[model samples]
Target: MTARETEWISIPMTVDVPYRFAAGRYLTKTLTQLRDNGRIFAVECPRCRRIQLPPRIVCAQCHVRNGRWVELPLEGTLVAFTIMFLPLTDPTTGKPHEPPFVYGSVRLDGCDSVLDHLIHAEPDRGKVWVGMRCRVVLRPPGERVGDLSDIVHFEPLPDQSRPGS
Candidate 1:
């Protein structure tokens, strides 16, 4: 082989890096309650009175210490959503989930912050609407871990139906 053609080609490799995260005091309380009691908890700002999920010590908007803990209802309004056609890898599990699934952001009742998660609705606009009502469906208490993934998905309420149906 000629000297120019003898160049070695480098191959690309993927590394799986494992890491651990400590949920702070506020989040630890929220997650513990979620895992143990199967209930959702949010923190509220003393000044602005905005309730935020993923309970944090400080409120982002008001820039004040969050002092109040609120138990949020499972039901919420679907504020935004999209039909994901791409193979998206779930960072938590480090696995690529199947494509053409519906995922969306929901604003839980009595909470200012929105939570993003998988929406258990058909991948069609006709089935999913922006103002659709949804409730969180969590994994069984025994199967639950102290993480957001404990929520299996948000399922749409059966209030709306097709006109012909």
Candidate 2:
């Protein structure tokens, strides 16, 4: 086929699907704890000793069944982050998060996996950064549902300075 003879076609369509999710054994336990007791739980791999959030049945690292349930401290380090300028839909709530917000990945104390969520900080570069210490903020016990949305957001701890600033 010659380059000038090519035909381009475009189609536009929208599909809407709604469904409920079954959290199953491991995740249900984790979400339930957060909702009921305001606690975070992770599973530890017997072989590799890797601690994972949203507790999984098997360890990704060692391929062994994860059994030990460890309670993680709410405090963690903000290992990565970004100041978002666009309004993005929050999948958990099916709502649009307002623009000029902050989002980041937090590595909770003692857990290997990082949980990504909104950061309750000013949308300014000077206000947020990697290595910033943060703590999980959850809704009041009665208001919390058994889901990741139980966490309102991660708030940066006070009295800290960015490295080499």
Candidate 3:
């Protein structure tokens, strides 16, 4: 066969296909309280004073059990953000979503960390950046589960500063 033909025939038969997958872990009773109750909880490391979200059973920083559930505020600033260009399929629904979906790391008030979530703003490539304020959009009161997905994407808090001043 010609070189071009040989190259085509020698191509690997199996192409790696990457698709969205649903991943979850069964939470124990203690961790489950945050999701089902719409309350934020975190573990405060006694040694370092770092409040880790998702209330860990052990403290990774100090290598101890200096962790306990602590309530956290729902509103926080957007620490960072990105606009996805490729279409993403919702793992729950298994369908391709429109491109330009905004996602960001929101630093919930009173928590010394950030939780990555969706953004409820029209994603402009030029606008997304660090330190933009965002707030959690919680699920309906009656419908909540102890899961990261329980809190929907963050929405840009209203800009209280006067527009032209």
| Number of the top lDDT candidate | 2
- Angstrom error of the Cα, residue 147, model 2: value is 0.8
What are the TM-scores, per candidate, against the unseen true structure? 0.90, 0.90, 0.73
Once fitted onto the true fold, the runs of candidate 2 whose alpha carbons sit more than 4 angstroms away are: 1-13
Task: Evaluate model 2: give its lDDT.
Answer: 0.93
Q: Which RMSD values do the candidates have, in order?
A: 2.5, 3.4, 4.6
> Model 1 segments beyond 4 Å from truth?
1-8, 162-165
Q: How much lDDT does each candidate structure score?
A: 0.90, 0.93, 0.71
lDDT of 3 by residue, 1-165 (tens): 788766744455765667864322213432366556666766688888888775665677788775456678778887777888889887666787687899888888888878888988878855555776777787876677546667777877786432333
Q: Write the per-residue lDDT of candidate 1 for residues 1-165, one digit (tens) a residue.
A: 999899989999999988888898999998889888999999889998888888899888878899988999999999999999999998877798687999999999988889999999889978888888999999998888999999999999986864444
Model 1 TM-score, 2 decimals: 0.90
Query: Candidate 3: minimum summed lDDT over ten consecutive residues — where?
Result: 22-31
What is the RMSD of candidate 3? 4.6
